[model samples]
Target: MAETIDDKIKNYRTAPFDARFPNVNQTRNCYQNYLDFHRCNKALAAKDQDVSPCEWYHRVYKSLCPISWVQKWDEQIENGSFAGKI
Candidate 1:
């Protein structure tokens, strides 16, 4: 079955954050951490030319979902966070 945007986001949220960031334990705040990780992953993927997932997430986050709470995870990474390495 084809995965929906919600499925992708939900799956991402279920995964362990540290697994993606081996050097950082960003799971302190579940919701915030997940959203940040999701946005970062999306932006990084886009930067790497892997746009499908990023575009899907962006569409959903901008339309059906609301990602206003989490600050720009992509910007945080670019500003020297561990996210830049990923």
Candidate 2:
């Protein structure tokens, strides 16, 4: 059987050490997580499915990105001005 999105969510662990972001620069990871959170929410909402799984990305970005950056993004999202791909 194929793995469902729910199964993936149920099996979620912390984000592993990404080879792409070695050393003290987790910028890519943070940005990716931010994009993923929005994408997950949009996808699940469209399908009327559980959005809980999207929380992983939320947690990751929350831990890795600056609060101000998140706040700015939130504002941009609300105002339809965010530039980054969702």
Candidate 3:
């Protein structure tokens, strides 16, 4: 049997150190999670599939990113000004 998204979520762990975010700061990790969450949601929704897998990214970004940054990005996305790929 295949692992379900819920299973993955239940087994979620902190992300390991990534080359892209080698410094002490986790800014890149936060931003990447933000982008990943949106992309995951969009792709899953387009396929009419379960989106539970995307929750991992949401949790990461929510924990690592400032609320203001998230709010600003959301506004940018709404206004078509966000620079990152969705």
User: Residue pairs in steric clash, candidate 3?
Assistant: none
Which candidate comes out best when scored by TM-score?
A: 3
Best by lDDT: 3
Tens-digit lDDT track for model 1 on 10-82? Answer: 5653333335445543333434444544666768776886545544434333432235533555457457663
Off by over 4 Å in 2: 1-15
Ranking by lDDT: 3, 2, 1
The global Cα lDDT (0 to 1) of model 1 is: 0.49
Better of 2 and 3 by lDDT: 3
By TM-score: ranked, best first: 3, 2, 1
Which consecutive 10 residues in model 3 have the weakest lDDT in total? 8-17
Give the C-alpha miss distance for residue 68 in model 2, angstroms: 0.3
| lDDT of model number 2 | 0.86
Candidate 1: segments with Cα more than 4 A from true spot: 1-53, 64-72, 82-86
lDDT of 3 by residue, 1-86 (tens): 79986876677676655687889999989999999999999999999999988998898788789999999999999999999999
Q: Candidate 3 — which residues are off by over 4 angstroms?
A: 1-20
